[model samples]
Target chain A: MSLSKQHELHTRRYGRNVGVGLLLVGVIAIVFGLTVVKVTRGDYETPATTTVQE
Target chain B: MTDTSFNSQTGTYQTEATFGDYFALLKPRVMTLVVFTAFVGLLAAPTPVHPFIGFCAILFIAIGGGASGALNMWWDADIDAVMKRTQRRPIPAGKVTGDEAFAIGMALSAFSVVFLGLATNWFAAGLLAFTIFFYVVVYTMWLKRWTPQNIVIGGAAGAFPPMIGWAVATGGVSVESVLMFCLTFMWTPPHFWALALFMRKDYDNADVPMLTVTHGRRATRVHILVYTILLAILAVAAGFTSIGGPIYLSVAVVLNVLFLRGAWQIWRRDEDMSEADNFLTERKFFKLSLLYLFAHFGAILVEAGLDKLGWGLWA
Candidate 1:
């Protein structure tokens, strides 16, 4: 069946769905923010020992 | 995807688990203590952390605390169902089941620990992991049912958040973190025992070995008085620490005096007087205890902030 209306299940679980959706979004934002900060601060930078100096 | 419960009397499948029901699994009130103390711990440290990193650190710490709460609820579902205070919890009220609580708890526990390690440092992450384990396995599963000294020992679980917060910034433990931990650790027994003082029957009915239940309420009263005196001394002494200054000392002196007075009032009253007064003193003391803790931590946070501006301390 083609989707035409909100399913009873969907309506019943709407609040929980919204909450889960928002939480997932928050997780993504945190991960992305942490990454940008880490990279900018050179937290992931390698030590000079990683380079082979002849 | 599907969480449905069938009611035989109603002849319906009720979608009883709301977003709030799931949220309740996380004992949000306890998480507030975790968040506040951890935030204070992080800020109170000598080292400065990046704002975003600090925020993530607190968030992960709170999630770890909430995860442990869920686990505690799962383990205590039986006792919680019987206890009036805890009867409305998600599991006991039948809003969520034990298995679901356990799964969410485990998932969040692992997620929080891994994220904390990445976001801050592995030392804090490991402390968070130990806190979750201590609250769940040591406190909930083992100590809670087995000992009348449950709150004394299990209180350590609640006290770990600040230390974890300090760890988030300093990447190691120190005297200040230990002091903060001890403040909460010492405070827990009297705070909870006063609760047990007034709400005596709940523990007796639930068969949890509260000091009021195992010892007589008379003994519990003496215990409260003793612990409070010790707490007051510790509270005032902590004011001289590096975390403290003029404002902190003032807050400490005033609140500790008040807290000692409340504890003394509790000790002096007999049960007959207590029942006649409807536990007014115990209830008032309980209320003050909340303010007592928050104000102490708030003073610490203020000191930390002022220190940043080079105007923090009395000395």
Candidate 2:
């Protein structure tokens, strides 16, 4: 194979791999961010009242 | 300069740079040790880190370690090209340029530190930054050529990962974490000196001023024996800490005995012995040193697991 052709092949493969890796990282980051936000915000709580039982 | 080569047969220019070459610049073997030790530190900490946070911490720590490796390779390209053991490294072998390695290293160093701070805390990030600076600037650029004690001080850079790991968990340092760091720091001299005994010619040809090259084989052996004795004491004493228990104690005791025996053998060798015979013992000791480290850290991990299961000796 010609040198330029080999270089082109390698560049393409590297680009593809990097693209996939970045995509995965992006998804994980979004999920992690959301989880952090959710945990920090928490949820609404109701006041507790005492009850009498027979 | 671009990493390009003229292919006369193909009558064209091809880029010599590859993913593997870039990855090789990271020194994956060293990164593995950094990652493993850092993980053990996180697990052994009294505080429990969120699983995702721990994953991010380790990832960034590994990146920081890789950054230091790249930067070290960048600065040491000249000496690396001369040393037989390091001649095939990316920059030295013409697979990557020193400039490229430096750029990658700086970029990763920034990325890892910033993201780690955001993911965990500033303390761990700061420690990571210091580790990188110590390795690249202090060790590679300054101490390596100047002193025979290069490994002794430079080993601190490799030692900081566990402390960073512990900081990631507790957002601070402790005696336990420092002990873990000490384990690796103390192990470095004997380990590298053993290799130096067998490969003295490499350092001599490279003019790197390694202990074996500067102090002679006999002195290097004595130094190894002394450091090994100190390391054994520290390793056994570490077993009684919060991070350690019966399992870790057992592992530490057995490993230290064997390690001491190996060091003793190296120390007892006659100056008149055949070079080949001396090389064999040095090589054996060097190989055992690798196992000695991994087993110690692995034992720490087991102790952490046992503590979680409520089977810890102290618990």
Candidate 3:
């Protein structure tokens, strides 16, 4: 293959791979975000600072 | 071992690994567990750490965990390359250089330990340093390649985060902290051996002396059953401590029953039968196993919350 053709091929491959990776990441983030929302349900308080004392 | 695509061609398709590739070398999933357990340790302590300082301490410890993972990847790239599960790792897949991985790991190690010591206390820093050493030297370098008992002894690295967290808060270890350590430690063998039972080929190909390879699958099954019994005892004991309450006890009771039943079923399996048929059961246990640790520590936090409101059982 010609130099320009090889370069084009590499660019196309890289773009495709990056697109797939980003899609996977996006899906994961969405699922994770929804799960956190469901679990916390806006009832999230900062962790308490005091230890239990008798 | 240059490939034909690179060396044979005048115009080669040579690619260099990027910065993100190096970061990917760290086992982030494992790091999450370290962070959660450490947070529990910090929260459960008798003494309270300043919120800002505690956050920073746990952050440094997590970075320390990532550093250990990077170093492990660097060292184990050879074996990792051969194993199907680890073949896509940055170093083995030609996405990161071994030297680059080593440098990142070492730099992070120094930064994490020193800053942790300054931010929290020397005891926490010392524990972090030893954890990195144990994982790198004892587990990755020495035990993993040499023995079937690798995960058992090496499990200590994963178990130490809670102790370190406790030290960060209390400046010393306590029964509660040790129980947390024991819980993770005992849980490791069974968790990993299940993976080994399924992924036997990976260990065999790598020539790693995993229990499945060194001992037969039957032996591994029996060991899992035995360890599950021991782990159950340790886990249930934690429910009776100051950290435990009705919520924790309830969770523990349900978790143990399910876990013990899973083990019992596994022990009952004949070597001739395909694990594939009952793989769902084992996979369910694995999923629950993750929740098991998280829920236990989460319950500890709940107990702490209750104590603050004067409703804690221990109180």
Best by lDDT: 1
Task: Give the per-residue lDDT digits (tens) of candidate 1, residues A1-54.
Answer: 877976788888799999999999999999999999999999999887665789
List per-candidate RMSD values in Å. Answer: 2.7, 6.1, 9.9
Q: Which residues of candidate 1, in runs, are more than 4 Å off? A: A1-5, A49-54, B1-15
Clash pairs for candidate 3: none
- Tens digits of per-residue lDDT, candidate 1, B131-213, equal 99999999999999999999999999999999999999999999999999999999999999999988879999999989898
| Interface RMSD for candidates 1 onward, in order | 0.4, 4.0, 10.0
Cα-based lDDT at residue B246, candidate 2: 87
Give the deviation of candidate 2 from the true structure as CA RMSD. Answer: 6.1
lDDT tens string, model 3, B11-80? 2233555445656877888989999999988988878776666777888899899999999998998888
lDDT of the structure predicted as candidate 1:
0.92
Could you tell me how far off, in angstroms, the CA of residue A14 lies in candidate 3 after the best superposition?
14
CA error at residue A9 for candidate 2, angstroms: 6.2
For candidate 2, lDDT tens digit of each residue in B64-164? 99999999998888888788999888877776777889999998899889888877889999999999999999999999999999999999999999899
Q: Whose DockQ is greatest here?
A: 1
Compare candidates 1 and 2 on TM-score and give the better one: 1
lDDT of 1 at B250: 96
Docking level for model 3: incorrect
Better of 2 and 3 by lDDT: 2
